[model samples]
Target: MSVLRIDTSIQGPRSASSALADVAEAEWSAVRPTTTFVRRHLGAEPLPADAWAAAITGGPLPEEQRTPAQRDAIALARTLADEMRHADAAILALPLYNWGVSQHAKTWIDLTIAGAEKGERLLEGKPAIVLTTRGGGYGPGTPREGWDHNTAFLRRIVADVWGAELTLIERELTLARVNPAMEALLETAELMRKAAHEAASHAGRAAASSAR
Candidate 1:
């Protein structure tokens, strides 16, 4: 069994969202040391914007006839699709952009969403946790809280396309330095740690049972 960490945090290590993802990963490692870890860093080697557009425009791949770039795109798409489908559990480290997901995040979703043409939901019924990093507070209250597009859009895509069980852990790292705000953020991370471990233990048990 293993966990796939999909780090979509555009800011790399500086991303608060990625920090939470790391905490969650550490919890998993402690609770399930036997589980392998797989990392997909979008910043390092982002998938092409049109990798899976094959279903709509390019049609089936003809490897020999395709350009080098086209071949590269298809290969990444296939690899990503398989990873999403096969992982026992997955996490998406997200960014809050203009009150919604970043363009890169949306592109990843479009390529991986199970659709009429794709036929199978590689993410169907799997569990996924979203770690959101943001500059301002947003989620019903707080100034930019309306920008809390993280929960809603993620829920919709995961439910409709991937069918993955979902959890969201968000922290406003930029707000931490403002007096007690840092404490609040740390508390949120603790809550995320608790939840991530419980979920991991449950998934690990399920996998064991299935194997038996």
Candidate 2:
């Protein structure tokens, strides 16, 4: 199984959400050492429109864009899509930016899903887990929580657009319980890791039996 680990944190490499995601990914990898892995750090490397347009249009070749700055844009998008599809699982690490996904990640999402031929979501059918670190709580039943947009938007994108099974791991401490939050994160990752592994194992057995 291959796993695509996408970190959309705007804080570059120091993002807390990305940090936790790395841990979860490592755990998953340890369980399945042969799993192939690919990654996209959206915030650190924003998606370009020119390359995106070229790729979507399939005209003039994305590499022919002219100025050297446009370099690698087209190839990156193709590589990103290829990586996503080659993987059997995925991880999205990011924070709730203004109650929604960061602009960087949003761009990647647009280029990835928009106008890709039918039956094309690299994310489709994959077991995808989202790791988040929020500065406040946004759970349902709270008036202010309704203000949150990440869950609603991401849910639609992951389930409807990508046809993927989605899980969420969040650290929302509006009242500041630092240690407990870390512990909770660890616990959640453990559960997610176990579930992913068991599912893969079950699928393997089923496939073996069907081969008879």
What is the Å distance of residue 72 in model 1 from its true position? 2.8
- Report the lDDT tens digits of candidate 1 across residue range 1-212: 76778777667666666766776676666666787767878755676666666533433546666766656655566666777766887767876776778877776776655222365666666667777666655656666655566668887776666777666665554545444756757666455545644554454344333321
The best candidate in terms of TM-score: 1
Write candidate 2's Cα lDDT for 117-194 as tens digits.
Answer: 556766666677777666555667744668777767877877678877677666654223345645555555455445
Candidate 2 accuracy as TM-score = 0.68
* C-alpha RMSD of each candidate structure in angstroms: 4.6, 6.5
lDDT for predicted candidate 2 compared with the true structure? 0.63
lDDT of 2 at 121: 65
User: Each model's TM-score?
Assistant: 0.73, 0.68
Candidate 1 has its poorest 10 consecutive residues by lDDT at 203-212
Candidate 2 lDDT at 46 equals 67
Misplaced by over 4 Å in model 1 are 50-56, 60-68, 114-119, 173-212
